[model samples]
Target: MAEPTLEPSTEPTLEPSTAPAPEPMPPRPAVAEPTPSTAPEPTPPSTQRKAARRERLQVPHEPVTVHEATAAASVALAGIRERCTSAPKVIAVELDIEDGRGQVARLNFKPAAGFKAASWEKCVRGELESVKYPARAAPSHVVLRLQR
Candidate 1:
């Protein structure tokens, strides 16, 4: 068996390199500090409503009183009583009144006891038709009930 010869190592060994150092960041300029006020600024009122109510006056006149309406209607109403055969039944007259106009825009008759003649009801309506009320600020529903 032949013996193996030992060899001497002479090559220079090199060390592993580390990462390069980072450059320093430049300093930022000085900024003025904001001074707080004692009282905060007042904000204006917001009108955000999409559908606000109308500001215009509706009827443009004064309101009508019940006494005035009854006074205007009494004479016609009395004629109805005289013609009726029986004691008068309660009748409700719904009147649509316009501002500054004595004339009723519309009339609806609601009778507790039905009238024998449509003509009679209409006659009563006609007599009361000329009745006028004081001017009103808005259109009004006036109901009058009369009984004998």
Candidate 2:
């Protein structure tokens, strides 16, 4: 059998190639093309909503004149007095209903010690006393308390 052999290495070789290089061009005179600036159109204003001039006052309501104020006061007082006189008996007072509608009125009555039914009965009586007008004023309906 024959053996193979190799020659020893020379120092690593790196060399530049001999070739022509390129040249840069000269700058040209600048042309004055107009700048692309744009101006926007102005927005038109909206119409004013000045309130329809309030009907010019023909009658002066200044100071609510004494005779006028007193007249209103007298009428209000008479109505209150009438409501006070027609109040119902306290055996059972209630919030009078009208066509199945009952208005809310707060109760000052409170629960007593050890008896729920008695407290409720007192509440019913107090409700009667608190009403401003008699149940006869509107007898079409009555209060219906529902527990849920």
Candidate 3:
């Protein structure tokens, strides 16, 4: 048997090319500084004064408990019942109380089975507003349902 001999294969070897290098990036344009006229305009004195006044008007007060709010509402309801000629079967009242004053947030009525809702909403609102809450009572939303 003849022994096999190893031979070198003929293949092209890769070589580095001498190519021209890419051009460098151009310099960015310089930004101009803001001039006084180009700067944001200042708020007008009247607007500033109004904002200050509003801030001063907002005074913090103590929070009103649920019990206190309900009590106030109950007292107001009595007054409302007296003012109406014929009170509805059901009265639903929602109030927003703040700074010892109550404002009617919502008022609903379910008239008696045989009658229609009378125009007593305005009277109820006025009566509710008349109820004086605690001097330091905070803003609160209270809902009350009253039935005859």
Report backbone clashes per prediction: 1, 1, 0
Better model by lDDT: candidate 1 vs candidate 2: 1
Arranged by TM-score with the best first, the candidates are 3, 1, 2
| Per-model TM-score versus the true fold | 0.40, 0.20, 0.46
Q: What is the C-alpha RMSD, rounded to one decimal, of candidate 1?
A: 21.1
lDDT of each: 0.57, 0.34, 0.69
Candidate 2 lDDT, tens digit per residue, 67-107?
Answer: 33223223323333344343223212123333223332322
Enumerate residue pairs that collide in model 2.
93-128
- Greater TM-score among 1 and 2 belongs to 1
Q: Which ten residues in a row have the lowest lDDT in candidate 2?
A: 139-148
lDDT of 2 at 124: 38
Candidate 1 matches the true fold with a TM-score of 0.40
Clash-forming residue pairs, model 1? 62-136
lDDT tens digits by residue: candidate 1, 13-125: 47543547678888988875655765566554354332233554455454556666666667666776776434337655666667534443333444524534555565555
